[model samples]
Target chain A: MKRKPSIVVVASSGGHLTQAMCATSLVKRDLVLVSNKNMLDGSHFTRVYTIRDTQYNVLIHAVNFFVALKILLKERPRAMFSTGGPICLPFALAAKITRTRFVFLDTMSRVTELSNSGKIIKKYGLYDSFLCQWEAVANDSGAEYHGQAFDLGDHGHQ
Target chain B: MVKPLILVTMGTNDYPFTRLYNAIKNDSLYTDNRCEWFIQTGSCEAPVAPACGVIEKIIPRADMEDLIRRSALVISHCGIGTLNLMLKYRKRVIFVPRVAAHDEFSDDHQLQIAREIKNQRMKVVFPDDQFPLLDYEQIKEDNKLSDPVDITNYDLAEIINQKLTG
Candidate 1:
């Protein structure tokens, strides 16, 4: 029996988690959810990895990097789909080092420009595919337009 | 004893969006006391101002959903969580962005979100703007609650499935 390839879904809690789950809700393969504690409801994730909520703190970020690294090594996901915040940075880097495909979806909130996370992902050349919710900004950034990237109705249930 | 429920949330973000509460406290609505206000303040300390009604540091998800369902009006920071809740229920919402200069968020992402929402013709109030009651009243009169863009069919799961398989 072969193990199914895993996809690690990463985002900050709250809206980011909701949006990320909207995208991940359609996945038929193995999936792992990562974020700060108490951010998600129910048991949608195969496994949950909780990292410290690093609020622009350098030390906390370093801690998160190691935590992400450990999870990535253990899960060995083939791809990472992230609707991001500070957490995406560590996962993006880990995905890169592990040769995992990285996907960064610019939050729908950003209309004119890529979000700070999107900017950083681009700066480091981490994302295998950079997608935007808005076509105008997608054209501006030469990224693919993915229709609308966020949906409120998606409660992560298939 | 029954007052219209007005839900105020700064979302689950750790930063304190005190400005929204301050503006709401000073707004004419705060003095009325007739309206029952339920505030989900997140990481912000309990407000010193007595004007802010029923403050919950954090409400459980079930209770939050219930509150959103029952509330007549929602005043929220420009977080996607609250935005989705408002839009999902088609609840009338007043969006206030948290500013970085005020030490609320590390960046102006919420401000950007607010501007984009305003561009979409939703009512959004900035911090530097005059007292928000006038606009709030105008929105109440207009009673315009436009459904957000239809994007529910765009499935993230399907996208990932295709990428991994194809």
Candidate 2:
């Protein structure tokens, strides 16, 4: 049997996961989710890997780095993507070290600026492609803006 | 016949959103048995349960989706997940963004996103603003709605797809 290459998506459970799913809806490659919480029902991703979630915890990030490396080694994905809530920080580091193409989409929740994890990844030059959902935010940060993950326009109340 | 359902979600983050819970408790509809309420409180504690409904910490994603489908109006934290669902289902929504001042979240990102919200069906209640009184007529009106069009921005998804696959 042959193993298919996958695109590993990193995001937290709430809005980050929603944006990631919306943003990656067009991807034809096998989608594998690397989320901090396993809230998903496996309807979307080929596989789901849970990792310790953190924004400011240094030790957890360090541990998740190895977990990321292990998953990358096993999957050897075609690329990596994230709509971050800081849980993707270690995965970003691992993607750079493993030479996997990494695309980071700043979460739509941060309307005014890049998210904290996005700022860290951007500052460290860890991503292959960077995008922001907000046009003004993208303009300010130099990230690609291709509109939001979903339409905010009302559809006349169902 | 089932009563009109109101779903209140505070997201899955570990913040205690007592402010939202308190506001709902103080509302006139809190003790109304004609309507049903399911409040997913996350870490927020509810000392006084609703007279007619229940409060829970968290629920499965599928359960939440079902609740959203049945809900006439959704009182939600300004989390994008709930916003996406409300928009997808075209539910009447009251968005109360979690603010940093009250330790509802680590930062004011929810408020930031709340300000950018321009959806006619959705209303954003700022920290200074009071949670609007639950409107029974609108809830009953919304309960009649059926399916809504899918609103995912595939244009953005296509760009993202190209960035990853190209």
Identify the candidate with maximal DockQ: 2
Question: Which lDDT tens digits does candidate 2 get at residues A1-158?
Answer: 77657899998998899999999999988899998888878578989999888878899999999999999999999999999988898899999999999999998889888988889999999999998888998999999888999998877653
lDDT of 1 by residue, B61-153 (tens): 667877877766778888877776666666667788878899887778778767655323246878777645634343344343333344443
The TM-score values for the models, in the order shown, are 0.83, 0.96
In angstroms, how far off is B55's CA in candidate 2?
1.8
Enumerate residue pairs that collide in model 1: A23-B156, A23-B157, A26-B157, A27-B157
Give the number of colliding residue pairs in candidate 2: 0
The ten-residue window of minimal lDDT in model 2 chain B covers B140-149
Tell me the spans in candidate 1 whose CA falls farther than 4 Å from its real position: A1-3, A151-158, B28-33, B48-53, B118-122, B134-157, B164-166
As a TM-score, model 2 comes out at 0.96
Looking at model 2, what is the TM-score of chain A?
0.95
Q: Each candidate's root-mean-square deviation in Å?
A: 4.8, 1.4
Candidate 1 docking: what grade? Answer: acceptable
